[model samples]
Target: MKFDTTQLSQKTQTLSPYSRLPTPCSLLPLLKLYNKTISQIVKLWNH
Candidate 1:
């Protein structure tokens, strides 16, 4: 089975709480963590 990661990007956009945008460098770590959490959830669902 193939995992669609594009959905992850869409989900991340909605899940983010910031009204005003921060610099990309600052957001990188938070985005990484969010993506990691999403990946873990997907793994759990696959099992």
Candidate 2:
């Protein structure tokens, strides 16, 4: 599993231009919330 820049660029070509922009710091809270929800779902399923 290796990807060259050309391959990645080709793949991203179909996506919106904004998709190549750097991730914003505001996403950290959303990612934390998503992880917490997934952990809670896993805990419920384990029981």
Candidate 3:
């Protein structure tokens, strides 16, 4: 199986609470996404 990380960037992501938005709302989402991605990669390598 092949993984293309560049593809992830190609997908458009909303600025998501950039202006006039709660701070945690913006940060938490990103932290979650990063954790999930890291877990997935770890699983793949472990297998």
**Pairing residues by index, what is the TM-score of model 3?**
0.48
lDDT of 1 by residue, 1-47 (tens): 78889998888887888635688999899999999999999999999
TM-score of each: 0.53, 0.51, 0.48
**Residue-wise C-alpha lDDT for candidate 2, range 2-35, written one tens digit per residue:** 7599978877785867766658687888899999
State the lDDT of candidate 3 residue by residue for 1-47, as single tens digits.
79877766554234334444668877899999999999999999999
Best by TM-score: 1
Best lDDT among the predictions, by candidate number: 1
Question: lDDT of model 1 at residue 37?
Answer: 100
Candidate order by lDDT, decreasing, is 1, 2, 3
Number of clashes in model 3?
A: 0
Instruction: For residue 18, give model 1's deviation from the true position in Å.
Output: 12
Question: What local lDDT score does residue 28 receive in model 1, on the 0 to 100 scale?
Answer: 97
